[model samples]
Target: MILRMAWRNIWRNKLRSITIMMAVALGLTAGVFASAMINGMMQSRFHEFIENQISHLQLHHPDFVGQQEVYQHTGVPRDQLDRVLENPMVRAATVRTKVHSMIASATYTGGVELMGVLPENEKQTTGFHNNVVEGNYLEKHGTNEILLGSALAEKMRVQVGSRVVLTFQDVDHNMVSAAFLVTGLYETGYTRYDESFALVHMDYLNNQINIGNSFHEMALLLTDIDHIPAMTKELEVMFPGLHVRAWNEVSPEMSVLVEAGDVFAYIFLVIILLGLAFGLLNTMLMAVYERTREIGMMMAIGMNKQRIFALILFETLALSLVGGVFGIVGSWAIVSWVSRVGIDLSAFDDVMKEIGFSPVIYPVLETAFFITLILFVMLTALIASIYPSLRAMRLNPAESAKR
Candidate 1:
């Protein structure tokens, strides 16, 4: 009976009721879309940056990461690589030899991190072929050719077919120098990597260091990202002589950024709910004022005070339910559109790449976000009605009727 009365009473003030519903709906919609978009952009950037640039997993000698001075100290043997790659979860693997070196071309010179990679295997693991911008990826077993990042090429004032000399310390602590012909140039859209790293055929690097069948690091790709922790544990158990780290473990800064985005989303959600709470509070207070005479008449006719309170509470709950349902449905429609079309960041490509992020992102909406949003809006509406409902119950029939 109270629900029927509350429902009929809401129709008596259709304009005000609709205005409050619109405010609640808009608030909820903004909250849902904002959270989804930010989270989606962060996740997309993280996956591309980590998977394409940094492999899912890395194997190093116990002290290799700390003292990456030479390619030989933390070198993993070629024979051991085959055993590690036997795991079903391992999709691909590559061996790398890295050293800090000074590169010179004609009149220009700059310092770079020289990476020695196997031409054939590196592509299978790192998407190195797709990142090539100007020329082809390195050729197998080639000694005189090298690939330069676009920024590095510009720094050294060199292009394809230019000769450059690279100087670095060998495994024996002796200075090693080699001349390489620039066969290709690549732009990864990541400034830190493109400007700082150079790739060379592993054969030349091994010969310079006088080391055979050894590498500074072994990078691996997994078929599924969820299997990273389990596979890392397995690798550790299988090869207790080596150190293993997942991409998230290797890149703590990126992980923190992803987590921080989530925290911010939650904070914004609370702020939106608070605003909706105030809106609901105002509406419930107005409804109490407008219906005072009607409520007093019911009390004068011997209606119980508790029954009057229940009627007010029921009306508030009905309004909340209607508004909450519409808000959730409307948000779903907006999120679906944005997720499909995506928000473009092409104009900010240079800025994003400078900070080690991908330029384009697609939004992802999760079920938990939707469910939590609905519950929060409904709870806020209920809480907002408490004071208004109590005030109506405390009114004296004589005083209210006189007014």
Candidate 2:
């Protein structure tokens, strides 16, 4: 009976009911769309970091992380790494010998970390070859070939085929200098990583340091990202003396951005709901005020205060549901369309790229958020209806009927 009455009451005042309903729907639309776009942006950023910079897991001599010396490298070679790749979970792994050094051209010298990498293995692990803008990736046994980040190349004022001399310490802590031809230039879109690092054939550095097959780092890329924790655990057990870490462990700030992004998305949802609540509260309160006499008549006829209160609350809920449905439908349409084409913020490209971010973002929301939205709107209606429901319940039957 209450449901039937609530339905009839809302339509009797279609314009007013619809206005509040639209408000609710629009509020939810804004909230949902905002969440999806931000979610997409963060997800993109996370993947970019994993693919370009960190891969999935890194292994090194336990002291290598602390000492950061060329001598602290691992003695394991490519074959040792391939043995682990036999595991189904391990997709690809690459060895790198890192040395902190100054890369100098005739005109400029910049402090950089020289990363010695096996071309094929590094290509499989990092996909760095795909990112090359000029020239080609390092060739196997291509004597003194160097792949440089475009920003790093630019900073040193050199381009492809330019010879750059790298000076760094040998295994014995004695300084060794070598000249490498710029075989490739890569732009990772991550300016910091690009400007601070350079790549060369692992054998070149190993030969220079006189340590055959010695490496400072081993990076493992997985078949699936979800395998990170399990793989990290397995690798830790497999290589006891080596330091094994997942990308998140290596870069906590990126981890924090990913984890905290959801929190911020929900906070935005709440703020939108709260703003919509005020409009709902006013509409419900007015409905209660105008129906005072009718409510009293219902009470006088035989309805109890509980039923009367419920009827008023039900009407408000019905109104909110109408808005919530429209909002969900509209948001779904917009998100679906926008997700494919993406919202291009190319206008803000300069600002965005400056901070190592992409301007184009595709908004994406989880399925759970839609369910949560309906519940949130219902909750808002429940809270908004409280004062109005109480007011109806307080109406004096005889006096209200007379009024």
Candidate 3:
């Protein structure tokens, strides 16, 4: 059969065939590794964003999202918070008052998103306690204790026990400034969060502003993010007056990221595949040129041009198939091992943290990538074989024997 002939011809020059296989394998391995690394980094950023900033869902005053003014409190009574918590999918929830305000230390004044939180509840809602780099989380019944992010602290040159003035407009648009003692310095590893956000006790903002029985925002944690859609609808129906939204709705940039990541992976795959395709074309072309005399002999003995073309394509496909297997399986083994150990990126921590990324990355490649890459390699093989196969088909039995 033509298939068996093509298989046998490959072994006639085993060294050359093996060399091409190695080249394909190595090229694809590098591609897969790079793709996995990028995916891992993106995954880490999203995980951190969800864990530290956007809890799973949020409930806010309908007008709060529009203007975010001081007076746009969640109109829902405080006691109804229990009704939202009663859902089985709800893990934890916390209410907060937010104001874009300025925190002034002795000689520094910096803008910050001042958050009034119930410390213990917030721990369950957003992992705030674990992010604390210095000092403990807020006390249960604290008056004016504040938590400062490391970047904010550095910008203000303020440390623990430093008294800072927080000046913002109250609900009535009256300018009110309150003094808060910095009880803790927290570092969320996200420089933007650190540079612009600080935490304080909710009671201070509520009583100080005289917004009794009301909160501006409520953040929720779910048993799993998959439950967000269902929970959002449930809560929206329950608190019809409040604007309930999932994390993605709250952060459209992250929503776009989650959707567009696959496009990025495919682009990387195409670039690498093109590189491999050139190498494959060169290798296959050499195989055809070296086998010109043999190809002529076969044609003289009655093998047709179509059979010769088929033979060359089959050989190229076999070469690519073997290499594709090695590349996919081997890359997966490498990525799995590294995922456990993690690739230390401490050298680039400062730059990475500025982008809200973690220093260490654990490479991860989905099983789908292997299938896609294997098919892509097959397509590359098909394209690479065309020119060389045509060259073999054009060979003259009498003329090819001379050289």
Candidate 4:
């Protein structure tokens, strides 16, 4: 009975009721779309770093990971790596010899972390070969070949086929200098990475450093990212002496950003809903004030205060649910269309690239998010109805009927 009365009473002031509903609808639509945009940007950056740089997990010499000393190698044997590769969860694995060195061209000299990698294995692990923007990926059998970042290439005033010298300390604390031919220029759209790293053949580097069959880092990509925790544990047991770390452990800041992004999104949504709640409160308050006489007459005719309160609560819920339905559907449609087309922020390409983000973003939202949002809207309606429902419940039958 209360539900029926609540629904009917809403239409008695159709224009006012619709005005509040549209306000709620529009507010929710804007809020949801904004959350989707934030989530898309964060997801893009996460994938970019994971797929193109760090892989899912990495194994490193404990000393090497801490100090990055050229002499601190993993010292794992070939058979150990073979066992790791045999794991079904590991999609690809590659060893890398990394060292800090000075790279010089005719026009410039700068510091870079030189990564010596096996061409084929590295390609499977990091897919960096696809980032080659000019020239070609290092030949599988290529010797003394180097891949430079496009930004570094430009800074060095060097081009493909240019000669560059790398000077670094080798094992036994000896400084060694070697020349490499720039075979390719790659751009990963991460300014810091582009400017800070270069690539060469792992065999050649091991020969220079005199670390026969030893590498500093072993990076692994998993068949499924969800298996990271289990795989990390397996690898830890497999190489008890080495430090095994998941992508989150390797990049704690990015992990923090991911968690913080979710919190920020929810906070932003709460703020939007809080604003709409005020509008809802005011609208319901006006409705209750105008219905005082009607409410009193109902009480005189045997409608209890509990029923009166329920009627107001039900009316507020009806308004919220009607608006919420429209809002969710409209946001879903817009999000779907825009996600397919993408939102282009090309105008801020340089800034985006500098921060390691893609200029184009595809919005995404999980179905769970919509479900939670609906519950939040209902909660907001319940809170907003409290004062109005209490006011209606407190009306004196004789006094209100006289007015």
- Candidate closest to the true structure, highest TM-score: 4
C-alpha-based local distance difference test score of model 4: 0.91
Query: How far off is residue 30 in model 1, in Å?
Result: 1.9
Ranking by lDDT: 4, 2, 3, 1
List residue ranges in candidate 3 displaced over 4 A. 394-403
lDDT, candidate 4, 298-347, per-residue tens: 99999999999999999999999999999999999999899999999999
- Comparison by lDDT, 2 against 4, better one: 4
- Which ten contiguous residues of candidate 1 have the minimum total lDDT? 71-80
lDDT of 1 at 287: 88
lDDT of 1 by residue, 194-271 (tens): 989999988788788776768888889989988898998988887688889988777888889999989988887889
Question: Over the stretch 134-236, how does candidate 2's per-residue lDDT look in tens digits?
Answer: 9988875848999898888888899998999999889998999999999899977777778888998888888888777778888888899999889988887
TM-score, each model? 0.92, 0.95, 0.94, 0.97
* Candidate 3 to native Cα RMSD, angstroms: 2.0
**Minimal lDDT window, size 10, model 4:** 76-85
Cα lDDT, all candidates = 0.82, 0.86, 0.86, 0.91
Judge candidate 3 at residue 334 and give its lDDT: 95
Model 2: CA > 4 A from native? 140-142
For each candidate in turn, give its C-alpha RMSD to the true structure in angstroms.
2.2, 1.6, 2.0, 1.3
Give the residue spans of candidate 1 off by over 4 A.
302-306
Give the Cα error of residue 308 in candidate 3, in Å. 2.1
List of clashing residue pairs for candidate 4: none
In candidate 2, position 136 carries an lDDT of: 87
